[model samples]
Target chain A: GAGVSQTPSNKVTEKGKYVELRCDPISGHTALYWYRQSLGQGPEFLIYFQGTGAADDSGLPNDRFFAVRPEGSVSTLKIQRTERGDSAVYLCASSLQGHNEQFFGPGTRLTVL
Target chain B: AQSVTQPDIHITVSEGASLELRCNYSYGATPYLFWYVQSPGQGLQLLLKYFSGDTLVQGIKGFEAEFKRSQSSFNLRKPSVHWSDAAEYFCAVGVSGLWNKLVFGAGTILRVKS
Candidate 1:
């Protein structure tokens, strides 16, 4: 009965550092997604995983961004050499297969200073 | 490339007054539409969605949306506005069922006045 959750409600790091953000999806969910929301802007799609494989990564801004869902229940978003531009609220969501409504988790605010 | 647009950047309405937030989308085919509300420092909450059948859909908190295919729009409306209803509203279009990439509008900020 647990909902999606993300670790590190807030993270502050220097530019060019590497950071990893974790997400625990709801039990039995087969699809996971990551989105980024900048100040005063709507969330932008980052990546999506169907099961353990990333069904779509086109939303990743660049090669520096990567995500993985190894066990099909948890996902980690990786940012390499983070730039100040990467600072934003990272949100995670999960949904049942073939279901349109997605359950979202409280976002992890990442600040690259 | 599917996209969503919310023409109104912000709207303020008196409590108990009728309210409407316009949303327009551009997609190639029959697209899945959604409305979400996000409070400050909170994650998005689904208000309603339109995938088929009915042109009008009902959602939580007395919210409803009408999907007009001919206009490529799905406008959210409520007969009476409440102060708690003030929040950011997003209109999104699901690109496809397989990937389920949602293209969201910039968002419309609603303000309620008593």
Candidate 2:
């Protein structure tokens, strides 16, 4: 009955640091996705995972961003050498297979100073 | 590339008044459209979705949306709005040929006045 959950609801870090955002998808959900929302803008696709493997990573901005969902339940998005430009709310969502509707979690807002 | 447009950046309506929010999307094939509402410090909540079948789809909180292919629009409407309904609304299209990756428009901020 629990929805998707993200840890560290808010994180603040200095530029050039590393941070990791975690997402725990709903039980029995086979698909997971990550998105980023900047100020005054809508959320943009980042990456997606199906089961334990990432089905699509094209939306990842660069190599500095990476995610893993080993065991197919929990996912962690890792950012290397963060930049001020990376400041934004990171959202995670999950859905049942074959369904178009995605249930989103209260995103983790990452701030780089 | 799939895209969505929310023509209005902001709209204000009196509580208990009818409301309509416009959404237009561009895609090559049949589109999976959706409306989501986001309140401050909260996650996006799905209001409704139009995948197929009937053009008019009903969703949570007494919200409904009509899909018009000819107009390339899927506008959200409600007969009466409550003050608590004030928030940001987003129009999104699920990218075709991919796994339900959504393309969202710059949201419309809804303000409700008593």
For TM-score, the strongest prediction is: 2
Cα distance off (Å), candidate 2, residue B32: 0.5
Model 1 vs. true fold: TM: 0.96
DockQ for the candidates, in order: 0.59, 0.65
Instruction: List interface RMSDs for the candidates, in order.
Output: 2.2, 1.9
- TM-score of each model, in listed order: 0.96, 0.97
Cα distance off (Å), candidate 1, residue B84:
1.2
- Candidate 2 per-residue lDDT, tens place, A1-113, comes to 99999988999999999999999988999999999999988899998888899988989999999999999999999999999999999999998863556889999999999
The collision pairs in model 1 are none
Candidate 2 chain A, poorest ten consecutive residues by summed lDDT: A95-104
Stretches of candidate 2 above 4 Å error? B97-99
Candidate 2 Cα lDDT to native: 0.93
Tell how far residue A48 is off in model 1, in angstroms: 0.9
